[model samples]
Target: MRSIFYIFFFCLGFIGYSQELNCSLVVNAQQTGNENQSIFKTLEKQLTEFINNSKWTSRSVAPQERIDCSMVITITDYSGENFQGTIQVQSSRPVFGSTFNTPVYNFNDRDFSFRYLEFQNLIFNPTQYESNLVSVLAFHVYMVLGLDADTFAKQGGDAYFKQAQTIVNYSQQENYKGWKLEDGLQSRFALIDNLLSPTFSAYREVMYSYHRLGLDVMSENAKRGKEEIASSLKLFEAMNSRRPNSFLLRTFFDAKSDEIEQIFSDGPNVNIASVKETLQSVAPMHSGKWANIKF
Candidate 1:
């Protein structure tokens, strides 16, 4: 009985040792040219507030506890008539790292023409812009977590998947949406649509990675993982089929199931030539058809 008890305690310790969550973010801001101390100070305060208020992670880790993060904002160009700036955010955690860099969100003198010239020249409305910034920052955190889950799963980190799922579950919650620094900003704010617009393809790619990871986990124990993989694959197929001109669906079809299986079986070392061959076979059939379309 004592030996059995010791074994059980050892197993518990192993589980505890395997789970972890930590992250950090840096914000950088700059103006087009030298600006008054007051303007710079205002921008710094707004950026800091957004970071402090936004719940960037689902794991309940505090911002101060984040491992490494940096943000730099540069006012790149400020003509008397127009103000331009740049904001770059860099984040890192034990499992992942990412950077978001963008040109200044611009505002013109004409728009501020009526206000006191000093205040008018400020360009972007900090109050209005705060929500958008928060959205971008928050989503970046989500993406990093999602990708980390995939990477870790491939490398045999089941705990990471649980962490990723926590993030996904949190994002779907009404209360979580209200956690943003700016209460007035609606959930799924325009920033989600804008910052994520060009990366729609990348989203689909991640879905595929997630599906593969799910399948691998499920394969280890069919009864335990099967339902989750099936659900994830169904969602991926539906999304790929619906997207207009989705390169992934086209590529998937062109490659065919056999090729896909081979790629999966071969793991990450699978070559592009084999993938291309599979793509050629599968793409033709599914080019215009939804993956879920019924006969």
Candidate 2:
């Protein structure tokens, strides 16, 4: 009877663990001189709105689960050509009587040298600072979700990235030029593709770097395991072939062309389907060129 009870409890715990919800976001606030209080309040309001409007998944965690998250925007003493501050965001859903916090990301000790453009103003010039902001925020949110942007990029998770890129893309459409505040808020989807593309690009670079770094590490240690080393080299070559101009790829391949050559001696087998799938993931499904790309 005791064994049966333990088994039942174990299954319950496992189910609970698997059912935990995941939420993510990035918060940006300005730190003007002597207006910290007002700025903070505005940021809090914005943060609240941002959370409420986001599409959080696995809503079963809490009956009232509505994008449960918190954000901290601190204005630093440093100031100059760019506004300096820190953004700390924690996104989570209640699990087992405790909130499972997403990874705490610290965009601290940084500087922002851009125009104080309202989230709505970007609709006029989508390729400007707003696009950059969207991309940065997307990367932050993905990291917080415990999803390595680099790995996901290579594994063809572009749709996840595209959701982020849509924010930028939508902002550029002419129809929303005179959009209202509420409509502007909803238009964030436009920038999703712009935001996520850079992330995937960066991920490709990092993976290539890691492969080269691994090879160098193994050169000193022959018993470093062949299977693992071969796998890294294979992935590196594959990613490099896809994005040859990537900084990490250029650096890695340039430094160890011989090793990489040997690894892919059998030639490369391009995965066109995977690439298409990845592109579709980050491409805005609702508008623009994305509409032409069939899923």
Candidate 3:
């Protein structure tokens, strides 16, 4: 009975500590023109381990249920401890009853700048700003978490977004470019601010309706799914009417334009004339992809 008790406790402990993200990170320093590649390699390895191993939330996420995400950090300039570059973060979630993974969040942060020493420990402390490196990463991670959760349920990501907001609050005192409002409309501050704002609530609603109500039901009913997807896209009409080509709308299409195009071009055809119009109005930059949706 002692052995059985030990096994039970061990299993419980494993479940309790299950990490939330299956993230892959790549560090590119080719622009630095440094012959010594060891520093970049170490940065990649350490940051990869830091992000994948760290538990970002209290939820018990199984290994298979972990969110799939990737980050590409390109170093444009590197000297001593100071590194300046851009990071492209993307995340995807698996569609229900399908072998496909749908893109969730795709963002490029041009203001990524930080200091790091080789083998330096990377830790995330939510209450205070540890470093721009850690704060930037943790903020994006929460954004991915929040957006992914939004796909599964209506406003289910509020808690995660709130955590990201806390990081923003803590990091604003630093010299980071992305954390300040004056950085630009496309800055990280704008992204999170737009997400949490009541002005863009339709963005969250469309996220839930498009993925959970639309894509998740595709395998079961392709026609119904396509119809629901079109209906969900209509939610953006009201948003676009007020904001007219907002950053949040652009962000949504950045991750979903291809999928949206493919969904309407193939499978069962539904009345998408209005959705296509809304897409062109809100996400005109993706007009090329939208134009290809011949259905």
Strongest candidate by lDDT: 3
Kindly state the number of residue pairs that clash in model 1: 34
Q: Tens digits of per-residue lDDT for model 1 on 176-292?
A: 332233532222232233123444434434334434544345435433333343343344443544554354343333323432343234333323343333333334454233322
| Model 3 misplacement above 4 A | none
Number of the top candidate by TM-score? 3
Model 3 steric clash pairs: none
lDDT tens digits, residue span 114-188, model 3: 999999989899788899999999999999999999999899999999999999888988778988888899998
RMSD over all Cα atoms, model 1: 14.0
Per-candidate count of clashing residue pairs (backbone under 3 Å): 34, 25, 0
The lDDT for every candidate, in the order shown, is 0.37, 0.37, 0.92
Q: Runs in model 2 with CA error above 4 Å? A: 1-31, 52-54, 58-159, 174-230, 241-295
Name the TM-score of candidate 3.
0.97
TM-score of 1: 0.33
Candidate order (lDDT): 3, 2, 1
> Candidate 3 clash total?
0
Greater-lDDT candidate between 1 and 3: 3
